[model samples]
Target: MDLDVFVAAHRAEWERLDQLLRRRRHLTGAETDELVTLYQRTATHLSQVQASAPDPALTSRLTTLVARARSAVVGARKSTWRDAAHFFTAGFPAACYRTRYWWVPTGIVFTLLVAVIGWWIAGNPEVQGAIAAPEEVREMTREGGAYETYYTESPAAAFSAQVWTNNAQVAAISLAFGALLGIPVVWVLLMNAVNVGVGVGLMAAAGRLDVFMGLILPHGLLELTAVFVAAGVGLRLGWTVIDPGRRTRRAALAQEGRAAIGMAIGLAAVLFVSGLIEGFVTPSGLPTWGRITIGIVAEAAFLVYVFVVGRRAYLAGETGDIVEADRAAEAPVAA
Candidate 1:
């Protein structure tokens, strides 16, 4: 390649790209497409100049032009608020709705298991004894005692921040380690179920079941639902590793893994709301009905968000995956 002739030939195209990028307002559709085409061609020219003819001045100039053109072609991303709005309205809800089949069953099974364990412990003094001594149980259930005091032990704001961080960490772990054949997800769910069962059982045995429910329902409903959503998405990711369907295992995992990450972020916001409720409403002087009503309304709004907005987004082609340009480049696979 004759460096001078090559530069002379492509110089016009490069200058055109520079002009398009400098425009203050939007380009017409045709001009936009032309800018992209010129950007690609100039990038190729830069590579050839670098490889076949290393002219220090020419190389630097082409490099700058290519970089600028590339940025203009790709364009700046939307504002943070816009990105957030899109995630909640489309990405987050779609992910929840798509994975509903997995999480719904998980919620049901977990509820049943906790109920059974609670009933067994409530009815059998021996079972309760194996778990904890009667005096210890009494300490927890005594009016104005441990279970009730736990929520109010810390200042509400600090308590809410702490709960949000802890719950977010749990959700992050569930999704991050989901590819480990889902064992961690299952373990987390079982651990939660056992802990809740013990509380319910101990409370019931001490004739404080109603008190336990009144305190818990205020925040527990939304908190647990967020957890279940994370666990379900994680389990789905693990299954993708085992069976990738028509796509290669790598491709399937990549798709599902990205979706799982999106869910993790969305769940962080969900858990934050629940944490506030737990720290404020749960421990507040508000009557049981008022607290529970707040919880129920929040939970219902989430359900509607998922089933209605999510389904519509899914049908409209949202997969909760990273936007195409942001995704890693993949080699074409033969059908």
Candidate 2:
């Protein structure tokens, strides 16, 4: 309890510990051992001072020193690069693979819906007239018309950024609104289907179906797939809210929410590729076959990334959630 005597007794040990910590990078085996011993002794002194005669400046200094020493002894975590590598290699892909059951149906149903709507618009003259003026439809579907100009109007870099931003926003909205029992997700998917259908129907009616496909396929293949993935995951999240199965509703939401977040990040990268294709390849002087082939290859690569790489990660027990150490402790559930 004698403050000055306590300080005088511990000052040398504290200084030695501080010195060892400072030279931690260059420490030898014997010096490392000494550092640990000193760290423990200094910690004890800090405790004694706290209980007996705590001083504001001394306490803060000791706290910082102890923290630094602990870090040195335990070693710091890996950098952001390792975290990112794991996410792309395992976490993101595994989540997508696991959730494929949800999104596969979404993609199929969306395709069917678009086809049906396209058929209706293309076949029905009244529907076509109701949708747009004949001149407008003709102008849009004409050679070197609105559809082609749309891709080329802006500089490639600016257009790529713009498309990426817009698609990312759509994906974010689907994931964010998923908690509302998925009603908004349904609306999002339907709206996308309708818009696509309208375009296709108008083009087909104008006898320019090839033009529509050529322009759209160069980017739409991957872009729409990413959107479908988001909508599907959102609906799945909403379903968890309605029926949590073995998990409590809160637990289900938490798990699904984490997966949704991972999907959002993964989808952003996917959308970026699609945006690049739309901005660059779609507008480039490449023939329609060449542009479409590029889009197909990108889309195929993504599927392989999801199914092949993701399946491996999923089998290895990676969930789409944060690593176990980062997650909150959950109570055991009955089997």
Candidate 3:
């Protein structure tokens, strides 16, 4: 109730708290402890002042001091634009580069499967008939037909968003379900390969393989790569469940799972870029070579980013996991 006496009693403590806050980044352990204690006391004082004396200026000063001390004690872990930048530049690429062994082979295998399927379907009338009536197949593969018009069917912006959402979902599923022994991921990749193969087969049989290549390559190169990345990461996650090496299974899964989640986010952006190309460039008036060139450039840039930027970051000890300060504390285990 005696405001003057209270101010005199706590003035030194308030100043000390302020000083510690000003030097928070350089605080010794003892000083950090002192700051926490002072913060608690100052918060209590502010509460008492508000409920009792209600001194305008003193209450205001204590409120500000207490707020600063709370930040110092509790820390500000809110992510900012800087975190996003680091993830794209270092975390995402590092993850892709680190897991290249899994995904690179996945892409190769998937491509080969697609090619074999296409060859089988294009060469065999029975296989072609099994897919659809010959007439329907012919219609779909005809010039300016279903395959060519599919990209232009919707408004470009709407199509882009739709494509992005669909691809992002596929990528998310691949990454999220990897823990289920990666069976789902394999199935996903198979289904995608079949779909692409059907297109290739139909177009090749119709003597319009060029049309299919032109339409698909503009976005397929990057889009398929993203899917492969997700599938590979998912498979790795499944394998981690089987053989955790030096780490406990739980620890290894937790670490890889975090990186997979980050990859999901980063891959969403990658798919978005491909969606833009698919929606706009693929369907635009650009020459086929021009569209294909754009797609190749985008894919190449992504590879370079992974190998150059990502490799550098990984070598510098980045693991695509959350920074140590943000990671959950684990109980120490004997090696």
Candidate 4:
């Protein structure tokens, strides 16, 4: 038997078993004994096989071992959305303490994004023109477009609406890009920032600073901050590779993917909710104080959710209240 195959496959299985075992908050003595005994048998056999000559029948034995391991650990891959709710529980939230620190990467990506977008858009005419809207935005100039009928007559609201629309796009891109790592994340941030920079620069140069302020400050801070946070999640994913010192990329990514997705999920919720407010309120002739108040309240809610949700998930996991693990552990062992 080629015992090597058995050793390799069994060790792989043990990794899964070990993960299941350690995730427990506390293990009963009997349960711990069972785990330790299994580990010892598996480890001893693996060592002897590695140290000695191969047994001709080892292949068949190892194949059997692998099948058993697969059956034993099948429960682990079943986590679904229902699992996400418990993430808010104390068992999980307390475990994800690090997500609170995600801002570091998000800020770096946001700043770098502004620099690249600024340089690129400075020279790109079409991009610059699209942004600056040299002639009352595209719709206003086109005699039949909705802007001509809707915004041209009401320039302040139209401009404000357009600004809000563009900003919303930026925030969505930031969060969506996190799934692809920070490459697209940074791209999203930089591109939007570039558009904003050029548009603002040209408009201000044309002595339309008043027009732009009325257009921008109403929703820019909350919108832009959400985008930054989303891209930060992407950065967090990409940096996982560079910093996953002892862990394999796959293992590290699985954990990071959750937080990253959580970040994106959080970002999307903020954008959608804020977009509603910006679209309806900002362009509706609301006072600056009212706009500021809406923006502040919305931003606060977003921050609380971002910090709170992941922390809850982490703590939930740490709680050691292992329903899934317990059920899997209780499965009948076949002869």
Candidate 5:
């Protein structure tokens, strides 16, 4: 076909592609193929026109087509409110629990965080030196660091606030960092574990272990558990590249990750509930017996969920199970 004739014939179709892509999704393969052909055809024509044709009219037409193509891509992106919510709720925790033996690695990371934090507080000369100072010196200053500052005041409020903030942070971090699927997720989970280990350890070493445990255990267990769930999502993403067992890395991660959706939302809900308890019920200086009871109850609930309820809730079942996983996995990529 003549260059000008082909360019003119495609002008209207390119504009239609841009408009149609912007307005709706789920385009049939034939329709999409047509759009792709229109784009490629226009691009080739523009290149030929630039190199050989000197017609002013053809140049203007090519410029217009280029704009339309860029616009079409923007129109193609699928950033809906539902996708984002689904990404957090369905994308993180479920993947974490589903990926085989996820907890084992998470536990190791958590323990290391705890030990590092504990050592920093108990042994390092700077910390030990401060703790050993006379009571009068302690009394004179109000500028305690994060750990110490929380120690002296209304621990209930501090602990409660920490639960809410940390839990939310874990969810956000998991979803955002899952894109790369590496240390960011691991580090986030490890950081939480370290915080928990050190925070609890300091209380014990200072002889306020009972008070700290009582205050923290009421909600900390739930909150931390949720955080681990988020980390699992990231782990799922990373394993796609690292292990990729069988069907290409992309294909495997996509499948396993898809199956993990429910758990992510469930974890977010757990974080929310944990925040509520920490805010309303847990308080610093609660009696030892009371703290123990709270810890026992919280731990019991977590165990129950992990062993019994979690299995049922996190797993796909009945109806839409396999189909839904495929849809969730493809939805983002399709966009």
Candidate 6:
């Protein structure tokens, strides 16, 4: 089992495998067969060397050759525009449709929480005082005040980009940290709920509920929905950790995590549209009803995308995960 002897013996085969791999796309039928045969032989050589001589340099060379030959033999999946299209049209929406129960309930509970907080603040003088000084509250709720001017303070395009980046980060955080049992996701959602509640409460107390509605509804509808989707997916990830069902915890987490990543990408696009609405339509001179109508339409379209397009995709077996070919191979386990 002399290392040099082993290397010298297998060196020609390894080099041939490398050459075939380099021209893998143009290989003839016989060359392809040779490549597969060389790959198998090289893999065997690698195993023998590791077991017998264990020379680092020879092991490394054979490992690289075997890997390249394996790739040439098996073929690799490349990302294309079609892949992107499939993700948006089928993967993302189907994921949303599949997990609607989690997110739909999340949306409902979050809305109720915001409403309750707003109601408490509007009704209780103590709560109002605790939130801000009387004059500060007045400034925020007053016509043409801080609440309305915030959208217009920066250029529309810049504002929209900034908003999109911020929301995307939040969504990413929610999805990424979901494996931590969803604590961070809940915290993120709570913080948002509080902010919205404060705005709603102050405006309602000032009898400017209509003004608040006009300002928020245009973008809030879609914007909040995206957030809800992220949170729901995140919670689902956490729940997967708790109860992996028929699958092992590792397998369940891996599947849900990949789907969550896809959801994050899709939600970013969703947030971008809402950011545009918030920056332009929310601050534009359009009538309140018009702005709100535009928001409603955007939201309705998203719902239809989820329920109609997403449902069909889900029913057809899209789980918002990558294709099987792209997924990592899992080890077999006992039942």
lDDT computed for candidate 4: 0.53
Models 1 onward score TM values of 0.78, 0.77, 0.79, 0.55, 0.55, 0.81
Give the distance in Å from residue 297's predicted Cα in candidate 5 to where it truly belongs.
Answer: 2.2
Off by over 4 Å in 3: 1-74
Task: Report the lDDT of model 3 for residue 83.
Answer: 95
Show where candidate 1 strays beyond 4 Å: 1-79, 331-335
What's each prediction's clash count? 0, 0, 0, 24, 6, 0
Best candidate (score: TM-score): 6
Q: Least lDDT summed over 10 consecutive residues: which range in candidate 2? A: 325-334
**Candidate 6, run of 10 with poorest lDDT:** 325-334
Q: Which candidate model has the greater TM-score, 1 or 6?
A: 6
Off by over 4 Å in 2: 1-79
Task: State the lDDT of candidate 1 residue by residue for 1-335, as single tens digits.
Answer: 89779988888998898888788258998998888888778777776776568799988987788777756767656558978889889999999999999899989999999999899889999998888777877788899878989998999999999999988887888899989999999999998899999989989988999999999898888898999899898899899888888766776898998899889889999999999999889999998999999999999989999999999999999989978766533434457
Candidate 3 contains a number of clashing pairs equal to 0
lDDT of 4 at 224: 69
RMSD of each: 7.5, 9.3, 10.9, 9.7, 9.6, 5.9
Worst 10 residues of 1 by lDDT: 325-334
Clashing pairs in 5: 89-265, 90-261, 93-264, 94-260, 94-264, 95-260
In candidate 4, stretches whose alpha carbon ends up further than 4 angstroms from where it belongs are 1-97, 100-105, 108-181, 304-335
Tens-digit lDDT track for model 3 on 261-300? 9999999999999999999999999999999999999999
The candidate, 3 or 6, that scores higher on lDDT is 3
lDDT of each: 0.87, 0.86, 0.92, 0.53, 0.57, 0.89
Best by lDDT: 3
